[model samples]
Target: MRLFLLLFAAVFLPAMGSSKAVCHADVPCTLGDRSYHVRAPDDWDAATPMPVLLHFHGWGRQGDLIVNHGRIAGHTRNRGVLLLAPNGLGRSWDFWRAGSRDTDFALAVIEDAAKRYPIDRSRIYVSGYSYGSAMAWRFACEGGDGVAALLAISGTIPQDETCASHPRDIRHVHGLADPVLEYPFGPGGDPRGAVRLWRDTLGCGAGETAPDYAIRPFLTLSRTVWDSCAAGGRVTLDTHPGGHFIPHGWIGWQLDQLAGRAPRYP
Candidate 1:
């Protein structure tokens, strides 16, 4: 009986929770060995609910690296939005296939964070870059009402799998001369088709690629939007003049758009 109990303790308990007593943004966090990271603003209110952006890091990158990144981390902190970065298992997500275990893991990370902090689930966002963006599509599609919006950079959904019925705001950024993921569609997935999938799923209307250019003329970005969607969901696809990359000012742009500060699509 003692041996059986010891064996169970050794195997099961570790899988249930981290050995560490506390989780913080400065270091990698965990729920029974599942690795991720978190960032709360300088003024975090445990009692007051706050918005959070669950960002998935790109391939070969860990959650810790992203949490320390300036563009995203800095913007979210100033807005008092919590930032959660989850490490892909083995530094690679299984986003190539739909209904993957990584989808559940992404949701689990959010749930685990809620226990320690007062999270505003209705304002929950999921974001990513490159391969991580692919995972973001998967996460948002499978997450349903649990996902409020999506912000992806340099990548698209990996397949044509049916997405969730719930409406969600989606904003994807890609470069016209993207060499890695290639323009429009490539090894990663179909950029145009992915946004169209969201458009159709959310019941959005006609899409128009706005001709206006914000930011520098050198990096003028083209914005395409499908509005009048179900549940107020809107899909925006921003294309830049560069290669595969997170366009400058992209982070701030997303935040602004969410806060109703950016220009209207219609």
Candidate 2:
């Protein structure tokens, strides 16, 4: 089609033969009036297919800033995984219901990006914090085949919202003392039920908990995993003693776990 060529010429051409990413820190890839940020992995080869992680930023924040954070960038860089983050309209997301604007845009970004680069389609991942994490939940519900897994922190979907019966590899982290989104239950919905929705979709049995699962250096976590399900679906919930926040080395650790390089449980 005529339109397809125009897009390919615009998006795909520039990405070709460039060792660096099309978008990176302090720079953005503009799509219409909206923009997103990307950080390429260390020692990346242009001809090789690379895995990518799509991280949604929290309310009132831009994706540009997230790519600059050491917690996210430094960790993923070593794994050769590109960090792709989209800027939400008005610095926030409309994620309560499925088929929302942000979710649709996020999915389109995946399809669009795949054309521009040698993307490892089977390794696409989704993650978020606070309101962004809520978007992750909604995305899992509607993201279709574009999403491989989710790493959610401090958020959940709306209690009344319903999701497609699809299996996913989800690892959600929440602090029991979190006052902002709260724990187990949040202003949006009960995170336990959110985990349950995916668990049931996979037909996994009751969660097996490791009371003192320590992934990070100093912090001890309560890790629950459900692995006995169809299509190798896995749902893990990691809770800590602190409040609403990302435990040190937590995000990167999950990336390794999902890659089967690190342990998912003790």
Candidate 3:
């Protein structure tokens, strides 16, 4: 029994330690005064480049809060995509702050990730909820040089913002019953207008009518896709019957779209 226990400790303990080292739970990467949390899967290999998903939290929420409440880290981990959850200044993103360098901070985070890990530059994606969603749109529009795709949830671009960069694949997800950021239109801004801006910018033809599909018995989902666009750019709008929160299957479906495995939704 003693020898058996000795062998077990000699073999299994080291392996367990190695596994723990490979599967990082979440670690903070500090750049100047700002920082963000990064989590990678256990099977990550430094030699092979992997896709990265940088997620931003909504107003009054921090990076760790979204990681715990949003439950997107597990989805990204299952898909073998590195997850980056960046905390905005004072629990909110500075999207409209004139002197705030939030955009530069985001870029720095990506650059730091590339340096620290095997990040695929062509597959870098940005996603956010609520106020962070607005920042996501702003990021894609202004500094979308290396971003391959964007996922904006529960928010749209501000009316004053403009897309000065080239077109890219953008998917917007929102719930019709959201009281905070209402669907179709809201006191803050108009989602339809934002969708129209992308549609026109991407050079997509007139919108086509499509049937709404049921993701669940209670949650009916509809998708508006702009198929014909320049530079392979596509704009998609997904609406569901819910409130100011992301659906459970949204992250997985976004991963599928990125991997080219399945359509935008199940």
Q: Which numbered prediction scores highest in lDDT against the true structure?
A: 2
Score candidate 2 by lDDT.
Answer: 0.75
TM-score of every model? 0.83, 0.84, 0.81
Candidate scoring better on lDDT of 2 and 3 = 2
Off by over 4 Å in 1: 1-20, 165-167, 185-194, 216-218, 230-232, 262-266
Model 2 spans > 4 angstroms off: 1-14, 17-22, 165-167, 185-194, 230-232, 263-266
lDDT per residue as tens, model 1, 1-266 = 65664555333422233445455555677767687888776454334677888888888999887777876786676676788999888898988766778988888888888766678888888888889888888788777577778888887764355776443678988887888886555235744564766776777777776785765446888788888886577889888768977766677668767877862221
What is candidate 2's lDDT per residue for 1-266, written digit by digit as tens?
A: 65665555445444664454575555777766677877776556556787888888989999887888777776777787878889999898988776788877887766656655678988888888999988888888876445778888989876455567342678889888889987755346644564766766667786777677666667888788888876567889888878877677778888887788864321
Q: For residue 138, give model 3's deviation from the true position in Å.
A: 0.9
- What lDDT is reached at residue 59 by model 3? 93
lDDT of each: 0.74, 0.75, 0.71
| Residue pairs in clash, model 1 | none
Question: Is candidate 2 or 3 superior in TM-score?
Answer: 2
The weakest ten consecutive residues by lDDT in model 2 span: 5-14
Say which candidate scores most in TM-score: 2
Candidate 3 versus truth, CA RMSD in Å, comes to: 6.0
Off by over 4 Å in 3: 1-26, 97-100, 184-194, 214-217, 263-266
